[model samples]
Structures are given as C-alpha cells and as structure tokens.
Target: MSLRLFNPRVISRAALPSTSRTFIPSIRRLQDSSSDAPANPKLESIVDQIASLNLVEAADLAQLLKTKLNIQDVAMPAVAAAPAASADAAAEAEEDKPKEKTIFSVKLESIDQTAKAKVIKEVKALNPTMNLVEAKKFVESAPQVLKEGLTKEDAEKLQKALEAAGAKIVLE
Candidate 1:
C-alpha cells in the first residue's frame, strides 16, 4: 500500500461521501499509510479528562453535552381515550323489556254471595278503593275477562271502570 501524507490540522475541502461505505475515507487512508501519525491530542485529552472525573462531575458534564448536542425533543399529540355513550342508549335499553299488561286473571265463583269475601279480597289485592258493588261487578266479569285469559293491564282498566261506575245491583 502506498502512503499519502495529509496535514491533520487542515479540514478536507471535498464534500464527504454520502454513503456509509465511504463515510470515513480519511481514517481509511491513515490506516493504509506507512508513516505513523501521532494520536489526536484533542481526543486523547478529552477521553483522559472524562476518565479522571468523579461520578458527580461526569454526570454534570454529560448533561451539559446532551443540552448542547441534542437536535430534537418533539412531543406527539395524544388521541381521545374513550368514546362517550349517547343519551339515546338509556331509552334503547328501556324499549328492550316486555311491557306489563293491564289485565287480571280471576275465577268465576267469586261473584256468588257465599263467595263475596273472595271477591272483596281479589278487588283489594289490585286496588284498595274497591267497595262492595264494584267488587261484585269485577267478580261477575271474571268469567268474561278470564274466557281467553287477561293480562294485569286489562284487569286494572276493568277494575277502574267498575269502581267509576259506583254501587249497582250485582245479582239482579
């Protein structure tokens, strides 16, 4: 290998090669040179100074170097963590349940005088404002209401109508 002498103090005027393979051609030339080049005094002094420092001094120096040499400290924007539930969600849940019927299932025998107590019992079970004739009418209608079966909803409506109609001749 032929040796090419280069002045160490002078910076090269040519642009450094862009590729990784050619990044340090000057270093490669020194390696190929026959004459020994003195180790860089500045680099040697810096390395020796770092090695000599105590732990606290080394940490402070490192922090200073980082502050001076750092290129970027950009922060990325954060995304919303969770989507909120809408007001319509509660209404949707309520709509899913089966609506209770307003009818009642009652037996026919409760209308008879002997079974009057049972009629009163069933009437008060659904509504406390029930009186004798209203109870009787409700009991008498039991056959028709129970013909195909009645929901609690229908029974409640009939009971209200009977109560509103007031006292009447249940047997006659």
Candidate 2:
C-alpha cells in the first residue's frame, strides 16, 4: 500500500482514475439527514415506539391500526398504474354484455291508393278519438309515425296489422 492512499490531502481530483465509482450514502444516513420531526409529543412518542418494534410486531401494529381506524387495505397504485391490457379487458367485458333494444316505434312509410279506405279504418281503430276526416288526412300523410314508445311485441303486432291493410309499415 502507498502513503498516497491513506493521505486524503495528497490526492487531487485529476490524480483519481476515471473508472472510480461515486460515493452513495446508505438509507440509514438519508433517514438521519431528514429535517422533518413530529411536533406533537404523542405522535413523536408513537413514532419512537414503532421504530423500536420488531418486524412481526410492526406488521401486527399496522393491522390493529387498520381495524381501529376502520381503514380498508387498498392498493392505490394498482388503479392509477393499470396496464393497457387490463383496460382493454375491461372494455371487452363491457362489450360482452347483451344490449338488445326493448322499446320500438311503429312508423307508416307509405299508404297504397287501392287500400286507402282500409288504412284509414286501421288508423281509426288505432286512435278511437280520430274522426273519419282526421283519419283520412293522417293516412294521406305517408311516412308519418302512427305510434311511439311501444314494446317490441306491440310494435311488431301493429306493423303486421298495418301491412295487412296494404300500408307500408316500419318498426324502429
């Protein structure tokens, strides 16, 4: 060993080799250097006691605290740091759910001239309050909605009745 290794004052920055590693402080050193200290004596005492506990005791203390405070054990990072694949899986799960339509609208697309009277009668049957002239005017106006907000079965039935009367009907 050379005396230069022991004498710190003798070693210049340029004299050191380029491949030499930098000095990294240990975790204990960083912990000791922290300026934050609990202002409350009770909190300070609890911290001191917790610091002195063994690993098993510390874990038991955490569980006890969770129960006493009614704090649920949640992995916050899991939600915020979710992967793209997991998000796609969630979207796929939504897509897998059945989404059949329940409501329907019966629309009168067109009325045939030959069965104009029959179409008018059907319209009158559908709306009892409508008079003959009102029913005729309503029938003459092709591409008009006969009824709205009907169930699938009721709309289908209405469509069949109108179609049988020689009127073009549509269910939406």
Candidate 3:
C-alpha cells in the first residue's frame, strides 16, 4: 500500500477521458447562436439616450411620454392590494406619532419705548416692500398682528426677530 501511494502508475493522465471535444462544441454552439441573432440599432440607440439622461430629466421624459401616449397608469391587482394592507398598518402606527403645529399666527403685543425705532427697522426688514414710514406706523399700532397664517418655521423666525428688536411678540 505504501508503494502504490508513491507510484506514478497508480493515477495516470492517460486514464482520464478528454473533455476538449464536449467543451469546445458547447462554446462553438454559443458563438454560432449569437452570430445568428440580429442586433437592433433603434433599441440600442433608445437605451443609450435613456442612459445618458439625469434622474430628473429621465422622470420628466417618462411623464411626457406617458402624457403624449395617453397611457393610464395600470397597477397589478396583487401589488395594489399589498400597499392598501400596509397603509392600514401604517395608519394605525401614525396614531402614536406626535402631531406637529403646521400653521401659526405672529402678533405684535407692544414695543419698548426706547427700542421703538429699532422695532420699526426690524419690521421693515421683515417686509422689504413696506417703506420706513409704513413700518413706523405698523409698529406704533399696539396689539396688532404682524403676520397671519404663517408656517411654524416662519412664525418662529418672526418671533425671534421681534424679540431681538425689544418688541413683545406672541406666536399662536
């Protein structure tokens, strides 16, 4: 057994069957099949054109094509039902989410006598279209609404601006 393990005759290369015949035929078949298939230049050009477009441009092109073709969006029945089921679950989870204040009102309660000029300047800065004289009158009128139906961010910004100018302000 030790001699057999060391002998070259135990596993000879000649004993193996040739795989070149089977392997070469499959490769040749693939080449031949590919050569028989026709190349589409129109499709290739369209694909190349689409690939060159940025994401926004591609989306705009898709929208334009959809509109021009008058194609209505068709969703698969299974796909449509899946989102509806998930949306119900999502709606239930949303109930636990904190609601954010969307709309706000910024009211000017009053202005410090010493900072009246500064408050008027700040108000004018806030509304660039309003002249200095109009801004002075707007500031002099106590307990007046500076801006109404503002977004939360806009209201907070206005509140900070008024407070910095030594004016009493409230956001509702």
lDDT of 2 by residue, 1-172 (tens): 6553457656665666654323323544577658575367888898899999999999999999999999998865555566887889889998999788899989999988999999999999999999999999988987899999999999999999999999999888
Worst 10 residues of 3 by lDDT: 1-10
Q: TM-score ranking from best to worst?
A: 2, 3, 1
> What 10-residue stretch in candidate 1 is worst by lDDT?
163-172
lDDT of 1 by residue, 55-74 (tens): 99998987887789984556
**How high is each candidate's TM-score?**
0.24, 0.47, 0.42
Ranked by lDDT, the better of candidates 1 and 3 is 3
Worst 10 residues of 2 by lDDT: 19-28
Model 1: lDDT of residue 71: 41
In model 3, state the lDDT of residue 12.
52
**Angstrom error at residue 144, model 2:** 0.6
Among the numbered candidates, top TM-score falls to 2
Query: Under the 3 Å rule for N, CA and C atoms, how many clashes does model 3 have?
Result: 0
- Alpha-carbon RMSD, each predicted model: 22.8, 15.1, 20.8
